[model samples]
Target chain A: MQTKRMTFSSRWLPYALLAPQVLITVVFFIWPASQALWQSMLRQDAFGLRTTFVWFRNFERLFDNPLYLASMKTTAIFAISTTLLAMSLSLLFAVMVNRMLRSREWYTTFLVWPYAVAPAIAGVLWWFMFNTSVGIVPYMLEGFGYDWNHRLDGNDAMILVVLAAAWKQISYNFLFFLAGLQSIPQSLLEAAAIDGAGRTKRFWTIVFPLLSPTTFFLMVVNVVYAMFDTFGVIHATTEGGPAQATNILVYNVFRDGFVNGNLGASAAQSVVLMGIVVVLTVVQFRFIERRVNY
Target chain B: MVENDRFGSLLAHLILILGVAAVVFPVYVAVIASTHAPGTFLQGVMPLLPGSHAIENYRTVIFEGRAQAGAPPIGLMLWNSFVMAMMIAVGKIAISLLSAFAIVYFRFRFRIFFFWVIFLTLMLPVEVRIVPTYAVVANLGLLNSYAGLSIPLIASATATFLFRQFFMTVPEEMLEAARVDGAGPMKFFKDILLPLSITNIAAMFVIMFIYGWNQYLWPLLVTNDERYYTVVMGIQRMVTGGDSEPLWHLVMATVVMAALPPILVILFMQRLFVKGLVETEK
Candidate 1:
């Protein structure tokens, strides 16, 4: 809410400056979001002939439907697994890269370009690598007398999508983790080392605690990303198939509304997603506000 | 150093090497796949080494797209992707810059309200509100055009917030001096503020260009016309070609081409990309 001390006294210029952004927000963002909320309460009969106002029935039906509940469970598993897998590996990489004096830039350069690959492209790459016939990973798995086919196995499909999603996200989490590692005061670590604390003890007792704020922030971001931004990963590789094994909530929304024409259900699902996003955004911003003190 | 730890240093180096290999393995496989002939994928495991058909595969995809896959030429799709990314990056920056300037430098009514309105955008991502938003765009008849590709996506709260944060650190003396010289508001903004913000803008450009280029769903939703297909979405079409297994070589070639631009952008402007990325989250 702060502004410059000496400000411009303009009646029209400020409004003019704000007009374009406000216009686009209202037209493209606000109006559509409000419509989704409103449409979640309305139902259309088969053939789109009769429209009936049914308040909360759509939401109630969504809760009762087993598939919706199943999709919710699928989403939670995907988001949590992806977040953990991406964060832990990135943290390891960041710690190792942080130890280097001369080769840090080279290692970082090698690690960070994958952040630029789109989620859909990342999915395609991994899908090809795990393709049943030509995939190297499956071929290696066969050496251990194990079969790998995401097309038929639900667990295999989930693992495939998680690996794809987490793969694309590692570079982002790495950069953040590296930045967080760099920001920790070296004097504190040195003091711990001088206190007869070994490297392992020094890291757990000093460095890891200092990195908690960054970890929490990245957790919220990774969850949000795994939930919403992964539509492309699902769409491109799986299309939420193998008996809807990989159908997360956002993909469910698109599939129900666009592909299956279940408008009210999809809209209801969208509202639920918006609620999740609001909670996550609030958590993220609150953590950010508290981050200054740390 | 506190202690000589040659063993620990060696362990760190070994872990980093393995980590880097894990990270590069997928893309390495993709590049290897792109170089092989189409028949190389039909009978056995994908080849680990590059083949002589690299130029042939790249040329076939770039110049003549696989008609069986319903994909247009990669060259046209790449052009569309570039145009869309540029428009989105430039448009978001322009509008957000003006709005952030207004919020920082001018006293206005409903300022807090407008700020909150813009902030709400951070929560409602395009995926959650996909249906209604698509309806709005379709209602406005913007389905298959450049404007449809970028304009609806141009209003960015992140850029606005970043610029506002940058503006707060500017010394108040600059504005006071500009006023003493009788410079108007727009003039001061153009001459002084814009110059001061060049580095931030360039950093933001790197981030936003990558962001805009990597978009898949928005482009897929808006453009059904082959003339407007972006390379990212076009790759999906190639992979999902009806019934038969996709032509792995050409598909990998298209994938490589699709992912190259933004990767090059980040590599070339890594410092700015890192700065923009770390600061924007705050």
Candidate 2:
């Protein structure tokens, strides 16, 4: 809420400046969102004619629907696993890269470029790598008496998507974790070393605790990411396939709306997603406020 | 890090090298795959080494495209992607900059209201509200156009907030000094503020460019016309567009093409990319 102490008096100029953003937001963001809210309360016939207004019927049916409930569960699993896998792997790499005196930048440059690869591209690459007939991972897994076919097995499909999602995200998490690790003053580690604490002990007692804020921030981001951003990861490879095994909420909204042409259900899903996003945004801002105060 | 522990340093390097290999291997495989002939993929496990057909595959995919897949040339799609990325990036930075300046410099009624309106955008990503947003765009007859691709994606909340935060940190004396020098607000902004904000702007440019380029679902939905296809979405077509299994060689070639620009941006402007990403998100 802070502004310049010596401020400009021109009222019209400010509105003019704000006009473009406000226009785009209202037309594209707000109008569509409100349309979703409004349409969620209505039902249309299968023929897309004679719509009838129904109060909360779409949402009520959505909760009662098994597939909708399943997607929420899938999103939870996918988001949590992707966050864990990405954060831990990146944290380990960050910690190790942080220790290197000479090859730190070299390793970092090598590690961070994956952030640039598009998620859809990342998914395709992994999908190719895990392609059952000729994939290297499957070829290797077959040696261990396990047949890896993402196209058929729901759990395998989930793992494939998770791995793809996590792989694309590792570079992002690495950069932040590296920044967090770098920001930790060396004097504290030196102090801990002098106190006869071993490396592992120092990391647990000193490094891990200091990195919590970064960890929490990345957790929220990665969850939001896995929820929404991994649409390409699903669409390009799985297409939410085999069953509804990998259909996260965003993809479901798309499928239900565009593919299924179930306007009512899709609109309801969009409204629900809007509510989720509002909650997440509020949570993130609250944490940000707390962090600023601290 | 504080102690000179040789064993620990050695162990750290070893772990880091392994991590780097793991990170690079997929792309390496992609690169290797792009070099082979079409028959190479169908023969079973893809060969790990480079093949002689590299130029032939790259040349075909970039210029001719896979005709059977009904996709346009990678050259055209790459150009489309570039144009869209530039528009989205520049448009976002321009609008966000103006709005942030307006909020920071002027004390106006409903300023807080306007800020919240902009802030609300952060909650609703395009993925969450695709149906209704698409309907709105369709209503405007903006579908299958560059404006359709970029405009809806350009109103960024984080960029606006970042500029606002940066503007706040700028010392108030600069404004007072500019006022004393008989300089107007716009004049002061162009002369002083823009120069100071170059780094932030460049950093934001890197982030937004990648974001715009990496977009998949939005472009996929809007631009159904082959002429408007972007390489990122076009690659998906090469995979699923044809009746037969995808021509892995050309598909990989297109993948490499689609990924190369943003990857190069990250490689060259890593500091800015890191700054923009961390600062914007955090």
Candidate 3:
């Protein structure tokens, strides 16, 4: 192989090429993020006008309000349960599809097709299945002498939201898991089999550990998805209905800003949400970095 | 052992078949609902089969004044969505590809710092920045315009990150070969790099298109005028009437109509979609 050292002049070319991207990122992303930080300090009147800066007053209000605390609890439950459930189901489906010899392509294609659909549309579709009056699931339950109404009950509403969120996430996690499975060397599994290891043992000792990096990546991505990206569904299906049963943090932030026009409080809530996410992400990376082989 | 393998195969097929049905069933409901008449749908009874009323319902949605009060025509909303999505798709991909190409193909000072900046942007949700972004867009006089809707979303950290990963795996020898052939940077990117990265580009395009199509909050805030509403916004208006009962069938029909183009795209490009994701793992 012929090797040539990259010269100093060549290095500057890359930076010049990257200038447009950096400029856009600064304009759209970094600048807005900093502005959000600044907005967290100010107070707004009922008319949606910023009045003055009252440092930590917004944060104080956030801690003082019972609804805000309940929303935090709701968000935690929603995020953790959905992420774990979605990841497990996707992993199982990916394994089954990977091991299948016949109709594998057909199964894989059909399974991943849902991920391509818009989240807003998925919310609409799922609402069709969960609606008390017209939904199939409720109708079926009634047929079986069981009553189910997501709109009337808080717990039922939470379960419905979690299920809807997790369903949309399964195909995303499955794609990553399938990709991870394909990248693993078959020789390692063969070696385990030759050593008289059972299928379950081989998976536990070899496949699971090797798949950790992918799993960790999926964990971070899934948490973020459950936390922030689920606004469309919450807006569509429940609209934080049955007395705010399905009101996750992002939905709360949105409702405050757009619905009630409390821009300052909403901005403060968003700042707190961002703070939690940043802390969780940092902790996740810190833990995963130690375990990640690559 | 052969018997055991056969039993396992049967089990796998059974599981996958059930999973596929669950995945496809809701979409089936949406399609069926779209075809049903308003009177039939209001009866709170769903048919297992498609109806002949799809054309009628669609005509009502499009031709009739089905828009929310203070909202634009449905056709205009769809047009807004299409134009905004296309612009965002093209802009995002161009920025991502160029940035990825730079990071992978060249060395520079503060490279790692730039990389981290990109990664950090992914963690900052739109909720965090909406207040500031709203002000920024207002200040720039981009309110109620296609440029206002599209420009703020022109850069995406996820696309850039994905493309960078893809670019890292491109063979260095190909670039060196092009250089030795006396190809300049522009020729090298145009002829050698872009051609080799076509699949990745297509994959990124589909992903970005979906992202732009589904955007709601930013557009909702920045573009107050009904003329700039996207399809998602239009659907939301139909579903949420204050005192009047929402037309469920019409809403589902609009939802289904909005979803059709993307579904068709996915169906035709299924292989590329899977291939794109698979390559990301490498």
**Most lDDT-accurate candidate:** 1
**Candidate 1 chain A lDDT trough over 10 residues, lowest sum:** A285-294
**Candidate 2 chain A least-lDDT 10 residues:** A97-106
C-alpha lDDT of candidate 1 relative to the true structure: 0.93
Pitting candidate 1 against candidate 3, the one with the higher TM-score is 1
In model 2, the fraction of reference contacts reproduced equals 0.89
Ranking of all candidate structures by their lDDT, best first: 1, 2, 3
Give the per-residue lDDT digits (tens) of candidate 2, residues B1-282.
Answer: 556788878887788878888888888989999899878878889888999999998889889885644677889999999999999999999999999999999999999999999999998899878989999999999999999999999999999999998999999999999999999878988898899999999999999999999999999999889889999998888888757778888888889999999999999998899999989975
Pairs that clash in candidate 3: none
Candidate 3 vs. true structure, TM-score: 0.90
Task: Give residue A116's lDDT in candidate 3 (0 to 100).
Answer: 59
lDDT of 3 by residue, A79-125 (tens): 99889989998998998898877677787778876775666667777
Model 1, runs deviating above 4 Å: none
TM-score of chain A for the candidates in order shown: 0.99, 0.98, 0.88
> Model 3 segments beyond 4 Å from truth?
A1-4, A7-16, A45-50, A187-206, A283-294, B1-3, B65-73, B104-113, B169-183, B278-282
Best model number under DockQ: 1
The global C-alpha lDDT for each of the candidates, from Candidate 1 onward, is: 0.93, 0.91, 0.77
